[model samples]
Target: MDLEKPARPPAAAPAGEGCLVVAVRVPVRIVVLVLVVPVRMAWDALVVAGRSLNDTLLRPLGRALPWVGRAVFVWPFAGLWRYVLVPSGKGLAWLGKVLVVLPAVALHRHVLTPLGRGAVWVYARVLTPVGHVLAAIGAGVRTGALWLGRCLVVVPSAWLYRWVLAPVGRAAVRCAKGLARLVETVVAGIGTGLYRGARILLVLPALAVWHRVLAPVGRVLAVVAREVGDALGHAWRVAGYVSIAVGRRLGTLLRRVFVEPARWVHRSVLTPVGHVVRDAVLRPLGDAARAVGRATRQALAAARASVRRARADLRRTLLGGQTGAERKPQLTHRREPNGPRTRTLDGSTTALTKD
Candidate 1:
């Protein structure tokens, strides 16, 4: 048992590829690469930009769009369906059930069902017996007709066919067979002549044209088509490589010129400046704002307490020595037990004691 994989055979060279194809392929590939590289780079750039735009802007917008639509369009329609349309539909359904469905049901049950039952009863009791009587009469008539026809027509036809018509028909058939043989021979000769003439005039010439003229032209066209297809495939592959190389070089140039310097500025300059601003300016501002808020809240609380004391003193001087807050709340409703206690052995409510 050999476990090793078999070596594949080398491919044969294409018989159709000539000097013309070889000469065309190099220049075509070079020209195609030049033309395609710019387009490919633009395509790649557009693809990258589209992905970035989708990530940065369009995806968030798409996610937000459902909520916006719910707020603007969906919620209002839902409210209308829930509050207005649903009730209207239910009311209409109830009205239709009352006006249409109920009447139809009553008519079917009271009027149509009884009428259908009566029609079925009449068909079964009266019409079925009458149909049976007519069928019996028709069968008797048919039997009499068949007997009379056998006596008057069928016996005579049998005798005529056996004695007179059969002998004449046999003589006629013999003559017809002889005439048919003669006609067949003449037709076969004519058909043979026509076939030969048609072959000489039409078929042979058409065959020659197909073999001599069309076959060579078709083969040349096939060769040219194959060469053109191969050339195109080669050119497309070369163009892809050229496009990738150009894109990498352009990307490197752009990164070196713009991205590195911007990164350096952000890391080395802006970050330190931001830190300094946070410590020096924003921190002190936040602390001062918090202290001001605390002082305002304390002053407002003190003022509120002073107002309450003044109100309490005014109430004592004016209205009999008590403010409303000092008065006790009165009970309006009483709390009660859930039910009476269960009977014990000593109680008369027990079954034995009652008996």
Candidate 2:
């Protein structure tokens, strides 16, 4: 065997080094072309092609055209590129910058603008409807904000008055004194009226008239009480009868719910179906199962016997020819031997000879 070392793999390039080299070279090549032969050749080719095309096409047109017409045809395009297009492109960039600052300027102007003048102009315009909707929404928001601010300011002051500055006991005492004075004045007036009425009333005889009127009312009330009691007693008897009837009906209904029927429905609709399932389906299936079991057992027994015969045949084949050493005595001889016998290959039999 040749004892030689294996070759090693090449090392990997460093990251970004390959890309940086390519980027540097590509720009340098482009600069060289732009600054040297390619730029000169391109400029020369463009001038030559332009001159050739102008000579071939425009020379004929110029010959046929008036000078003023040609000048008019060229001047607008020339002016458009030099003035409008170039300036507009630059202005567009400037406009982009302006847009960045537009929101701040808009906010300042909107805030500083007089609301009254703006609203008058807004209402005069056809956009007044939209303006009104926006103004309404804005006013609603302003009102809500003012309300919220007022609540924020007032809630603390109210809490402070209630908790820190309120004189609860003094107010309660003043209220109680006022209420007591009002009550005492009313009671003194009533006492004065009674004092005046007592002297007049004894002379007037109003008490005797009240007594007579109350005696008649008492007799009438006794008669009304007896009538009402009798009516209520009759009502109670009717209610008791109704309750008994309802209770009997409810008991009968409950018994119907809880008790079995007086007579059962003989020969139910499912009886035939149950009989058919048991007799037709289940009986046939049971017979089939028994037959399958018997056949499977018989097949198993036959297979076992076949396996035993195959095993015997395999043993005989493996043992080769059945020599005396290989033969089983019980299988080889049908009866018992006399003493000992030997069989020769030539078919001669010899008896045992003792020494």
The RMSD of every model to the true structure, in order and in angstroms, is 23.6, 46.6
Q: Name the candidate that leads on lDDT.
A: 1
Model 2 lowest lDDT segment of ten: 260-269
**Cα deviation of 102 in candidate 1 (Å)?**
24
**Which regions of candidate 1 fall more than 4 Å away from where they truly are?**
1-147, 164-183, 207-213, 253-277, 312-355
The global Cα lDDT (0 to 1) of model 2 is 0.80
Error of 2 at 104 (Å): 71
Write the residue-wise lDDT of candidate 2 on 174-285 in tens digits: 9999999999999999999997898578835666765878778988999999999999999999999999999999999876775434322224545776788999999999
Q: lDDT (CA) for every model shown?
A: 0.93, 0.80
**Alpha-carbon TM-score of each model against the true structure:** 0.44, 0.24
lDDT of 1: 0.93
Candidate 2 segments whose C-alpha is farther than 4 A from its true place = 1-263, 266-269, 300-355
lDDT of 1 by residue, 1-355 (tens): 9999999898554799987887898799999999999999999999999999999999999999999999999999999999999999999999999999999999999999999999999999999999999999999999999999999999999999999999999999999999999999999999999999999999999999999999999999999999999999999999999999999999999999899999999999999999999999999999999999999999999999999989998988887756776878876642332259554665545457653
